[model samples]
Target: MNMGTRTDSRFMHLADIVKVNLELEQDWTGLAVHKSSPRGDGDCDGQKLLRPLLSGLPPKRLYIHPDDQIDMIKNLTGPGESETEWVLPLHQSENPTTISMLASLFDSLPNPPVPSRRKRIILASVHNDSTVVYYIVHDGLVKPRQN
Candidate 1:
């Protein structure tokens, strides 16, 4: 893809995603992570895929609805209870890169309290140890009560 030119301002932040992924590759051996490419099929109805680093998190639902959260809280002490995990499944099954990032559990931060854009980065120091993820987001909206 053309990496040398002025890109639209709308996608400016995503471009940083690409840049960080490339720069951080030096810390990882096989995992090739990048932000969703412009040509990516994410806009497709059922074509959502991960961007590598995010795939390493438990999976169930990223954003738990308020009602669901209350239901879960009501049953917090019950057995066989439902649990929530975040699975950042990336698209590498058909891609050339063999590094397919599957589900991973993170030990940082509480689950989402509201639905909004999530910008995150999973990083490690070395030896597959000392790992941490940082999530930064920007959103301002007055959510209407659906209940």
Candidate 2:
């Protein structure tokens, strides 16, 4: 098989893993797998290296801004609602190079409908045995939430 074919197959497999992990395991709703334009030749600086990203709404709010949390606590209000979040699914083997690539692609993503101070995504790392781990990534430094 050619390189293109192999890449395509691998992408599809990763997409499936993301879908199952989000929908079935995590019980997230409105899951969508966004197709990237194309893969590039190890050029992390270029747009061609963009990878597929998944977006969806989780059952509960996965993140709350520090300021927002303070306000909610002061007013005795509950966590309002969950917002749509971006998810980037990558194989465990790809983690080393993914950090550099993430900056470029994160900037390329469309702004969220609800205006916010920062851009964030859920990084979903898929292991060889199908165990997917998730981490929250932000475009820039954000104040830590109060415990």
Candidate 3:
């Protein structure tokens, strides 16, 4: 397919993801779709294929670092308000996403509210039936939360 057709297909998939999220009860806010531009000559050519990413704030905190969880327990403080998070929408039928692509996406984002916090994004896998399965994806290794 031509570049325009490919671009249009990606946009439609992104729209579907947004629509499914809006229809859910999470009350997503400050929704924004980001476009990526190709970088100058370098080893970052893969970044050029990076798709648009969705970013917004959920109604409640979706994740807390293991260290933060301990701090919260010690301080007897409840989980804080949710922060804006990156969302990558991928159609199930699409080719498997590459680590380099994800790394590029992570690099594009601004630092987290807490400097100690790790970078993460919500990976939304859209299915043909309009089902969107979300998974938390961190940029690097992080201690898993205890039950």
* Predicted model with the maximum lDDT: 2
Q: What's the TM for model 3?
A: 0.81
What is candidate 1's local distance difference test score?
0.31
RMSD over all Cα atoms, model 3:
3.9
What's the TM-score of each model vs. the native?
0.24, 0.81, 0.81
Q: Sort by lDDT, best first: what order? A: 2, 3, 1
lDDT of 2: 0.77
Give lDDT tens digits, candidate 3, residues 80-114: 98888888888888875988878777776666768
Per-candidate clashes come to 6, 0, 0
Q: Measured by TM-score, how close is model 1 to the native structure?
A: 0.24
Each model's lDDT: 0.31, 0.77, 0.74
Clashes of 2: 0
User: Which ranking of candidates, highest TM-score first?
Assistant: 2, 3, 1
Candidate 3, position 34, lDDT: 62
lDDT of 1 by residue, 1-147 (tens): 254233323133333343344347423222333233212222322222333222222222233435555676898832332232222322222232232332212213233333452323333211122232333221224232255
Candidate 3 Cα errors over 4 Å, as ranges: 37-49
Better of 1 and 3 by lDDT: 3
- Whose lDDT is higher: candidate 1's or candidate 2's? 2
Provide the RMSD of all predictions against the true structure, rounded to 1 decimal: 13.8, 4.9, 3.9
